[model samples]
Target: MTESDDIRSTLIDMLEELDDRLARITDDVKHTQEPLAKDSEEQAIPVENDEVLDYLGNSTRTETDQVNRAIAKLEQGHYENCEACGEHIAKERLEIVPFARLCVRCAEKSEE
Candidate 1:
């Protein structure tokens, strides 16, 4: 397979693994919530379970969406090209962040 195809496959695998891990974490957290609540007083700062769950859930959703979007971009003949300059993104960077939409130069300039 080509490099972009390889990257896409790896990212798909990573995202699926993340989804499984997040589901397990969510269930474990839910199971612990009741015991945690029973011991803590109401006035004791709320454990912020909702906030934590929301953050974790949103993160997983966003990551899944991003992975799908990246794959779509690949199919549409745009993979590895910087969105801003249309230059090929370095393979090293792509290896680090398979969903990257910008090359290092464009990304660096944007941070200014």
Candidate 2:
């Protein structure tokens, strides 16, 4: 398959994995699979766990959105162009981060 096709496939897979993780996190936070602890003291653990799970779910959702955007860019024939500078993003960078929207320089600047 072509490189863009490969990247698109990888992004789709990543999106699916993120979606599954978010679903599990949501279910865990809601106590869908297991009931809360009966003991008041024991309840603290699950509550703390739920907080962490919520954070993970949020991050996962963000990544899912990025992947979806990348897929859209690929469809539009603009996946290789950095959103910030309109420069071509490196092939190696794209291989490593299929959802990347910025090239290395722009990405570094944004982080600063």
Off by over 4 Å in 1: 32-46
Cα lDDT tens digits for candidate 2, 1-112: 9987788889989988998898888887777337756765666677678778878988998999999999999999999999999999998998888889999999999999
lDDT, residue 36, candidate 1: 48
How do all models score by TM-score?
Answer: 0.75, 0.88
The most accurate candidate by lDDT is 2
Candidate 2 clashing pairs?
A: none
Per-model clash counts, in order, read: 0, 0
Tens digits of per-residue lDDT, candidate 1, 39-111, equal 5575354356667776888888888887787788888888788989999999899788888889999999999
- lDDT (Cα, 0-100) at 72 in candidate 2: 96
The Cα error of candidate 2 at residue 43, in Å, is 2.0
Residue 69, model 1: lDDT of: 76
Candidates' lDDT values, in order? 0.80, 0.88
